[model samples]
Target: MKTYLIATLAMAASAVAQPQKAETPSPEPSRPQMRAEQPAAPKPSRGAFDAMLYVSVQDPSMEWWFNVPEGFAPHISEIKKIFHNQEFSLFPFADNAKVKEGKFSISYSISMKSPDGSLTELVRGAKYEGTKVADDIMVACPDVIDFKLDGRFPEGLYKFFISAKDGISGEISEYENHIRLAEWSAPVPFTGKKLVSDYVRAFSLQPSPEALYSIVFSDDFDLEQKGAPNSLNYTYLGFMKAAFKKNMFLISHIRDSFKSLSDLNRAKFILILAILGEKGIDASALSEPEKRYQEQIRAFKLPDPYGKWDPFLGAAQIDMLWGEFFADGTYRPVRRILNILSHAKEAAFADELAEKSRAPKTQAEWDRYMLGRLYKAALKTVAINARKYPLVEQYCAWALLHGDIPEVSYEVLSPMLEHIREMKSPSGGESGENPKVRMPRIDVESL
Candidate 1:
């Protein structure tokens, strides 16, 4: 029980975030040549709709900020805005008719002033106008904007002043809007006592903001003199999407900061974070479908009445019959997939998916445990497979033992674990003998 758990969780998560972090963005290039680059881009015929990734991306002029697509920006009124929710990821889309053609410049300036001081020129004169294309409806691909705090932008109200001038029309649209940038998330050390991973899991996997405050109630721990969770210290989960990395980082920090923990709680706590870190929810690292699926999950609700959303993307692979979630997150799909995998002994798909889903990469010491977590995707299926595949059961049991939340673990798994036991013969398994699967004993030392 050496406290490598914190480091292991961080390492696993950082391993995924490292690539994006490695190329820490410097100033964006000024030219916006953006010309030759587009001609070579894959040509997909679709209406011109502007898309942008709103994460922590930087252009030459700005620190950590968002970028508008190079061309065909619709009128200020033309932008389609999706209001923030518990999911907090907003996709701003513009009509192709508003796409800017010819040479034009979009200048963005950001400034903030508080009672204590006046802040100006945090980023100014950041101009983007490139990729000359027709003004018609043939634009493909969504423009991306990365909105984030690189720890520089201060909290409080600030104006994001945007001015667009047509190089040909000699007409300009000027508008300025205020945005509140809160302090980005960071892990907090336990000021007094350590809480188990249950607190961490509850906070991170909160279905709604209303559910989180109690997880870290002041009555439970010393949260400064204020003795309560406050905006100054912690952010709402609604902001978790854009700041997901920061959120997880903060959670890991909490996990690592434990002043004390029982052996059992520590083991369970590490497993919860390790699995999530290994299986990231990074939008940058997901397919379009994956991005949508995750969106629904983050919101804890998927409105798929029209059948427009899918909850399983890469994990389902070619055969979605075994996928994990429905748009509404019912476990029917989980059950269906498990039944198929458990019965489809002629095919290797189930095992393959289980193996592939297990820590994409991990030290050998914890690989089996990771695999157990992975098999949790089809927990019921895992239970069935466990009778004949002891290793599969071991992994599944380990995964189901420590859920993303306590309720999830106990409510869903407690019965399942008991059912699994009931399926076995009194001696051990179905045939009064333990299945002799040759998987190595779980070596958690590396974990």
Candidate 2:
């Protein structure tokens, strides 16, 4: 139940105001370079209209190649293999051009030739106006063009021909480049003793948190047997610590395992899955696992520990609902929160709070208002149930730290933090006199 609340908040802020550096691909000597480095064909002596096209694997990184000298020779040493879901950008720079009255026009066309010798036009006759930067310098109005290699495109080596026409001088410049489109490579499958040994080896190497997250959430990762629960021990401590540092790529592969688990086992995994889901992890690639999780929760017949309500179940549901609201800005999830509140007084207070809430006028306002309400409701749930279920205290700490609401003052959260600290025994024994609970863990070695 330990959350990356502080790290998550920091990441959220940095993501909004920063541009991410492009991912550098590993060296591959076998890849072919683009033919654009060759000399251009002789042009007619009438008027010179020259342009150069530069490619970047990431859109944000295009700025690095934007301001080359007029006679700079462009060379693509190697084109990295791109995943089907990834996107690359093309930037057209006008080296020499003719302009009239500080105005010029440029149009572009892009064609892809597949390995089978069939050609497909990805872009055709896209026009943009150009501005004269100086007496003889002209630049494209919108210099960047993005191409996404989604599912529609097949995996193969593709020959790309990019042509740009100078409308004023009736001259065209073309560049030939090659790129390979591919699918995300799956990890090699491992089970039983191999799984545990490999996982431990990977931990010892100190692989990046992002790399560890990918391995754990990959489709190839699985436990030894279905429905057999385990407990968190020293083995998973490193992985969980690394995973908590990441706030994105929160995908989980535990749905298949959860489907056949016992009531309490399912509930335990669901809570962990829900916490991860709040960070944008996909429960399933295409299916609605949210609906399935909810259905299982409704069928739970276990002893309720938090008075009339099951705090563990409620925590999972609330987390999932909050995640959904953040993703799609849907009001249905907010309405569902009222139904989940066991206390009429708390529900009534939430209802009144929603009723008195003013309509948001902008996107930022909308985010602030909606997120504020959801966190308030989450805080109320924690306050009512944290003392009853020690796990609830973890959830409470997660909410207070990760909510990022400006209205929540330190004076309000300081006491809660102190209370949580007091709940923990110095010797790391059972928290708050509560009996030690065997939380559900994945049994990788058994598989």
Candidate 3:
């Protein structure tokens, strides 16, 4: 019995010592290996943003910056009329928080959609690229973006849309606004339509002829058809500022070497003569003083006796050429051409222009006499005297549009032209019926 018990125990021990194979995990139902990553939550979608923005129809290459109205209502209605082929600037007020990244790009599109479902793309998906948040909050619009739009849209209610895309996050935010071009303010009156058509033909150029004179000389029809191009059409002041934009290409390239003021005496005189020839303004029609002056200039007509003038303008100007068209800046050339008739030209005006050119930001200190010289020179060929109220009014209208002088100064002249009187004071003053203007007491019948 003891032997049998020992064997039985050994057998039990053997049985206990024998190891069992591991059981395999049984496959229940076929299941996904990844627990289908809860399809990432859709990115946040912020509704359209209308940031504080300002538009400038200047050259496209200019440093187009951003501005948000300071806590007050924006005076967008005060914005003036715009034109075609104009460099339209669009800026979005961006801050550090919303941008989230240093680099981003904004896609811009402009279109005119009619109520009848006519979809016309004025600007389609043009990208303003390589943008970054600027250090100065005021000028946050990056230089990389093409802020200019080559104004081509016809008269219509057009929508302009801008979208910002975050490079890092792939998130997008968008903004939109609308603009309407009532009309490109043309030169006033019966003469302007014909002049504009003539300009379209005469100034017709593929890449724009090298210079104004070159265009005049190159095409036979251009010269033949462009009668009084300067006198009638403004050779140096086209609607697109084409006339006065001589060295503007340098500015377009963001180059610092732009000679705004140069010896345009030869150019000015030649252009004037060419246009005067077209006007059929008899050189004999000049007064005794002007006739004598023309005789003396007739000797040296080829090389015009142009004097010092600053054709030099920076960034922009009135009507793009109004200030220039006024010929106030053409002190030396206009004076030399007009001579005795140039009693209209004065010394004080030249000094003011020199100072202004030196310090462009500071406004010139000009007296009423100097003001007369500024406007009178432009009328050397046109204005026989101040009694020509229609001529005077025409000049006033041009000044209002182009801003030859400071807007503040025009305040003084506005009344004088309105009441058909002379400017008697520099700063504004009261009179019985009409306010006296800051002007010199001269015979309007004579220069």
Candidate 4:
């Protein structure tokens, strides 16, 4: 079967050490004004539901206009109700204290059931400064206040409305759905390899990360050698990169298509592969996250040429990649890799390049066929971790079938396969060191 894989880039954001398959970043522009034009935001899709809301808390001392009007105060509980799990503190009212005037930036972030939710709208507030006059809250309406949700949110684009009190006065105020309340959700549970396979087949996408690895181990491979040199040459960075990248797709599919299976199947499979691949590599390795961190360090050769604390930046990058990927499905790394693999000839490259190209590794590697091997490794990793990670196995099987590859075998790796078959827990849970895992190595020798 043509293996569909989410080939991970390095874990470290500043992976200066990874063997330089690409060239140095372009030189900084000489003119300051020329560089002043910051990078442009990704173009929104045609006919996409990209909504924005701005919230300005007017002064309590005055008419006390809120982002919403006084009539809608009853719904305040409903609005705040949705954000129960969020680490938010309700700013208490000081009797007659002045309302602080500032723009509350909230990003309306949308994602699929998977970690990689697809779209993020910057909900910007108008130039909101505290106005000493009554109805000062009017300034808040000019733009939207932005609060961004990081993970899977409830299934709906945030809705906006306004309600006001009927009194001697006109509408005291109005409250738009200024604060978008939504959560990021992981994929739901499903059972039976055949059933799961059928789901994937019907969907034409990968499963959740937790699902794929859970199943891959059932086939065959040596878990003991998972991270050993070229037995898989698997690194923590690779897994993280995959998760981060797939999230972009996951998030986009849900946001764009109303969480329709038909729209998200492809994205779902990719997310499952990327996440489970990371879990499998982590589960099989003895040192785990730390070991992975070290591998990235060795590969990239930390500090100096890469910059000080490149390893930290790299780790941050992994997390950040996940955040961005989950926030929107248009991140650069994963999409670029997927684009190449999707379009590349089946058996293109015969050997690694003898002469280096000045292109970046992402662009340079596009011409090479190593992506195929990387995809295979990602697949294998998912399988190996399936036993230890049910979510990984389930999702992998789901993704494989979705992609039209039926009946995968371990090729039979290690006892991990058997362990997965007999494993108990299906509810995917997060496992790994909290703060620090081993670092990864980047090969920056050529740089």
Candidate number with greatest lDDT: 2
Please write out the lDDT profile of model 3 over residues 106-207, one tens digit for every residue: 443443343233554433444433333431121123221122223333455444444554333444555444455543322221124445344333332212
Q: How close to the true structure is residue 339 of candidate 4, measured as C-alpha lDDT?
A: 24
**What is the lDDT for 248 in model 2?**
28
Q: Rank the candidates by lDDT, best first.
A: 2, 3, 1, 4
The total of clashing pairs for model 3 equals 11
- Candidate 1 per-residue lDDT over residues 193-277, each given as its tens digit: 3352234323322222222222332233322223212211111121122223323434433354333544333333333333244
Q: Which candidate do you rate higher for TM-score, 2 or 4?
A: 2
User: What are the per-residue Cα lDDT tens digits for candidate 4 across 1-447?
Assistant: 221111111122121111111122211112111112455334334322122222222111111112111212101111222231232111111011122241121111211121234332222121212222221111212221222233434534343332222121122222233233444344445546565434322221232333322322222211223434333312222333433343333333333433344322323333333443322123232234434543453354211211221222323222232222222222232222222223223122412232343332664354343443443433344344444433334433322222312122212122233432322222222222212212222222211
Backbone clash count, each prediction separately: 19, 2, 11, 110
Q: Candidate 4: which stretches are off by over 4 Å?
A: 1-188, 193-328, 338-447
lDDT of 2 by residue, 71-94 (tens): 222222223455554445554444
lDDT for 291 (candidate 1): 56
My TM-score estimates for the predictions, one after another, are: 0.28, 0.34, 0.28, 0.22
* Candidate 3, run of 10 with poorest lDDT: 1-10
The C-alpha lDDT values of all candidates are: 0.29, 0.42, 0.31, 0.27
If ranked by TM-score, best first, what sequence of candidates would result?
2, 1, 3, 4
Report the Cα lDDT for residue 27, model 4.
Answer: 19
Ten-residue stretch with the least lDDT total in model 1: 5-14
Off by over 4 Å in 3: 1-54, 64-80, 83-117, 122-154, 167-172, 183-447
